[model samples]
Target: MLIDIFHDTVCPWCRIGKKHLFDALAKWQEQEVHIRWHPFLLDDTVPAEGYEFRNFMQNRKGIKAEELQHLFDYTQREGEAAGVKLDFEKIRLAVNTKLAHQLIALAPTNIKNDVVEAIYRAYFEEGLNIGDINVIVAIGTAYQMNATELKLQLNDRDVVDAVVAESAFARLNGINSVPFFIMNNQVKVNGSHSVEVFLEALNSTALLDIPAKI
Candidate 1:
């Protein structure tokens, strides 16, 4: 089975969904499952320098202070339950994740999940600015990727365009949300579903002879 996950690095729910998917995989009897990561920019218009997290939420999303706090609190509780420790207060910047997605794209299929997990941990858990080239380089190096090559690729217009194109393809398919999962290109599951839900989908897809999408 091939699982293509359409998600953004900054999405807290995406992180949770990743954990749920992995948990399901751990219990799955099948050993031939392949997972692919696809980019979805939550805020594609964000500047390269990004914006202060609180200000962006308030000014752009029009979220008031109390309401924002409630939302963060709820998300943090859910994250903890999903084994993700997101430090909302420590996150100062809401970054543009195009570069991060490009870095993940550079990784081999086997290590792509590691790259994605590192990006999520740096942004949400450590509150690092993933949009910064230096920070992205450091994350790639820590994952044993070539730092100099990764830095050069990050600045390359072609690589950036590829990531943008992938996002466009996702939108063309009517995928407007993060954490969207497609199994074998025949079954689609959206949002941060439970581990049981993912397992059920995996099992069901294995048993069905659904025609592959064109």
Candidate 2:
């Protein structure tokens, strides 16, 4: 089965959703599955250097202090339930994830999933600024990708355009949220649903023409 996931690295729900998807897959009994990660920028207007997390939320997102606290508390509780530890305090910057998405697009198929996970952990867990070119290069090197080659690809216009186009296509298709999952390009699962919900979607998709491998 093929799973195409549209998500952003900065999205707390996306990270939690990924964890739930893994949990669902673990109990699926199907051993063979292919996943394709797609790009979706939550805020395309963020500058390359990025903004302080609190300022971004307050000024750009219009989130007041109490509302922000409520969001943090809610997401942290939800993350814990999904087996993901999200330290909102550790996150200092709200960055432009275009380059990070480009890196994922450039990743080799075998390591694409690893690259996505690493980016998410780097930003949400470690609080690294994934928008930085050097940081992105460092991540690629750590994942066994050639740093020089990856850096060059990251600066390529064609690569940037391709990822941008993907985001645009998603928006055109009425997908305005992150962590959207499409099963075999047919079944659409939106938001951070529970493991049981994902399992049900998977089971339903299996009944389609392409029987899921079990």
Every candidate's lDDT? 0.89, 0.89
Q: Can you write out model 1's per-residue Cα lDDT over 139-176, one digit (the tens) per residue?
A: 88887889888888888999999999999999998999
All models, RMSD in angstroms: 1.7, 2.1
Candidate 1 ranges with C-alpha deviation above 4 Å: 209-214
> For residues 1-214, could you state the per-residue lDDT of candidate 2 as single tens digits?
8888999999999999999888899999664788888899888888998899987887766879888888888999999888888888899999999999998988889999899889988998899999999999999999899988888899999998898899999999999998999988889999999999999988888878574332
**Would you give me the overall lDDT of model 1?**
0.89
Clash count, candidate 2: 0
List, in order, the clash count of every candidate structure: 0, 0
